[model samples]
Target: MILVPGLWLWRDPWLQWAAGCAGAIRAAGSQPVWFGYSRRVAWTAFLRPTGGTAAELVRRFLALYDRVRARHGPPSVIAHSFGTYLVTRALSDFEGARLRALILFGSIVSETFDWGTIVARGQVTPARMRNEVGAHAAIVRLAAALRRFGYPYGESGVTGFQLDELSRSVNVRYTGPWLADSALARYCRGVWVPLLRPTHPPRRSVLTLRSRELSRT
Candidate 1:
């Protein structure tokens, strides 16, 4: 199994959350690999998240995945938060490549994210944490769409976007709001940030894109 951590965290997670996960997999008689990365930008944890960071994470994951696969055939993957995006992006290159499983924890991926398009050559077990949050306002949804997926700005009345997507086993669906519907959500418009920032760049513009996803109960 391969373990990955979230944003603002170093790729080398042996001393962090990866430690527990790696140990569990080891006790299960399966070997675990710790991926390494330096989430450094602007020399602060609050750096703006950019696509470059995600891309780099994906690159590092692929490197280790390739090495592990060469030896162990295919390795299951476990990732949390932004690391989830990294794994998703990497496996996408080998769409439909069968592995043991792909587990995600506290994933902040967008609603429209195509989980079915994940890397799996066979029926892969998917799991995630699910907490329910109310639907978002039209403007909140609109701003998130613009920021997360880079949707073009236009007249869109989409009030809520919800998906209880079945994920690869070993994880949970993250239920967090993309934008808090309050005095801030009203004017927190035109938000944008590169993947290089802290979470995912939607929030750093005015809020944290690594937001509590608006989930369907």
Candidate 2:
């Protein structure tokens, strides 16, 4: 299993998720390797007005992929939140990466997901009783439309946008702050705990580049 933790969550005291995943994989009789990316390589970076930083981060990810594949066979990748962005970018980097499985949790890829069923299940309520419309209805419509015709953000010419298509094989498991229930907590505890307690925590200063711009000042 290839575990990837979310942004800032990859930092020690926050990277418990990766360790937890590793443990789970071990318990299931499989060896897991943690694959972490810098926080600056966030999803928003891909959409920023100046996407130079995101482009550079993508290049670094490609280099990391070379090393990981050389050491480990194309393995099952598990990504959460911001790290999901990296997983998508990396998959787009190589065609024959041999991804066994992709488990995505707390997904931040789309602003809206399946909500019709969520509302029927009482997961959310209409903002105004009189309006009779869930707040996230619009986003669900957008996601539906995009999924129908493939990715909507970029054209075929775009380098990284191609990863959006891989969702078909990627097993997505979403855990929103809204879904703060016991079952959800237990399912994600493994990923969340170890990320919070790392043996060699990364320095916060290591994050010099921001997703928004190249200028640190």
Candidate 3:
């Protein structure tokens, strides 16, 4: 699994949280790769009049993905905040980029991102895509508000993905402060570990069961 962290992480405790998540993934019997920028990315970078920095980051992420895929095959990804936007753009705008699964938290990707297209193209498994939404994520809400001023941000981490009912992307909502350590630990152990470990049924069987459950609702 590849772990991508958000901007200004060097100044915040989330980097430690990310490290804990990596430890959890390692404990779950999977390799965890941490993809970080060479320098600190400040929150002000997002307000740039042009998308130069964002585009460069996407390019770098795709390079990392290619290298990892060539060495260890496709990898599952866990991204937060701007990392989510970077991953989403890499998968959506580029071809031949593959992932086994994706888990996003504090996502800033547009709510209307075309996830179904990526699933249809076999870039990411449909049943394995998850968006962890935080009900009290004020930062994501602020990002959504900034979208009106031409910022490329969204409230998907707050409102979740606005995809169709049949879409395989799962939006798991949690209620709490965004940076609560206890909540993060719980999610890493209880939610993300299961997603990465594959202790459940095969993808097709899981999809079939999900379809049946949806039919009943």
Best by lDDT: 3
Report the error of model 1 at residue 128, Å: 11
Query: Residues 85-130, candidate 1, lDDT per residue (tens digit)?
Result: 5565566555645555554444444555544544133434343222
Q: Which segments of candidate 3 are over 4 A away from where they belong?
A: 38-45, 175-183, 198-217
Model 3 lDDT tens row, 59-112: 888988888888767878988877788888888779799887788888888888
TM-score for each candidate, following the candidate numbering: 0.53, 0.46, 0.81
- Candidate 2 C-alpha lDDT tens digits along 15-38: 344554455566645566665455
| Minimal lDDT window, size 10, model 2 | 126-135
Worst 10 residues of 3 by lDDT: 40-49
Off-target runs (Cα >4 Å) in candidate 1 are 9-13, 41-53, 119-217
Candidate 2 contains a number of clashing pairs equal to 10
Lowest lDDT sum, 10 consecutive residues, model 1, at 188-197
Could you tell me which residue pairs clash in candidate 3?
A: none
